[model samples]
Target: MATPVLSAERLAASYTYHAYRQLIDDLQAEGKTTGPQQSELLTNYTRLNVQRMHRLDKTVQLLPELREALAALRKPYVWLIITEGWCGDAAQIVPVLEAVAQASAGNITTHFLLRDDNLDLMDQYLTAGGRSIPKLVVLDAATLTEVANWGPRPATAQQMFLDLKSQDLPFEEFSTQLHGWYAKDKTQSTQRELLALLKSL
Candidate 1:
């Protein structure tokens, strides 16, 4: 028998975008920034992502290509994202995803699930055999069938990470370099890749 598929409906019922944002806020209120399982570096990074998300949520501009693609979407879909408060990549990407879902104008809705809390689901969407996070699993709301998926980071960023990883850079150095790339890119690469993914669906 095939492995049981987790339903988008269940995940969405567990956590919506608003709930995820609130989770961050609650963490910040408790003088914590990262998830229970993460390190101090992730704490600081998570704080930055919170600020970034707020700024991007207000000012992130969707490229014309993404806008047009979203406009052409007739079928409704669910963007079920697996993430956690400590995930720096999720902090950067989730806001942009929310922007995309908003631009879809009722054609799409976004949801969130903490990676640790949803390991069974995350295992199915792992990045290169590791439980790397911020995976976006797009599904048909009516059937809970996957439409498309994208995650962790844009291709360019992922490659940069891989290159640095090959050198076995220290965690601090690796994070600094990775975040530096994210700062410079300003999420353009992410938007471009997600647009392509959506268009293909």
Candidate 2:
């Protein structure tokens, strides 16, 4: 039998239930189940909050490129998931990532980093204009050097910024985009680069 490729949907679902389970446990432990304080917050379903119990249930399916991403990452990898508990993007991407890690079996060790919790480490990347949560920083497990980084920022910009001082690089329009990042490319270039990086590895 051939091994199955871990789809993003499955990952999302796994993460959802896992997160929900924790929430439930916490609520029970704290006995704080009331109004919006607990109910609304509980309903917010984090990145790992909900999973389709039945396969037939209609849910957001994984995009093709994203599926390709899981395949790109080989075994024995280290993944740093730097994210905020409330960031929408983090909730959106975590499940897919979890699914990928799960499918890979013992090949990957995922380290979840809450941005607020790791201010010191985040400070390094902050200089590179990394102010957002859920940055999936992929690095070499052996050397501890960054293989590449992916998140809310452009791959080229992030890579360049990591490799050189901010002043050395021509802080061009990609520069201007940070102020209005919505106008920038849809991260397709970044994803493509990630794919290439994985293939090279």
Relative to the true structure, candidate 2 reaches a TM of: 0.50
Q: Candidate 2: misplaced stretches above 4 Å?
A: 1-75, 127-130, 153-197
TM-score of every candidate relative to the true structure? 0.91, 0.50
Candidate 1 lDDT by residue in tens digits, 1-201: 332256545754767788888878887777676445756666677787788788878878889999999999989988888888877778788899999998898999888888887788889888889988799988887777787888888998899989999999998799889988988988899999998898898
Top-lDDT structure, candidate number: 1
How well is each residue in 1-201 modelled by candidate 2, as lDDT tens digits? 322222333333322435533554465455442123344444443322223111112333444665566656655766666664444444444544555556555556566655655566566565346566557766565544566666754556556435544456554443344423312433344445545545666
Evaluated against the true structure, the overall lDDT of model 2 is: 0.49
Model 2, position 41: C-alpha lDDT score: 48
Please report the candidate that would top TM-score against the real structure: 1
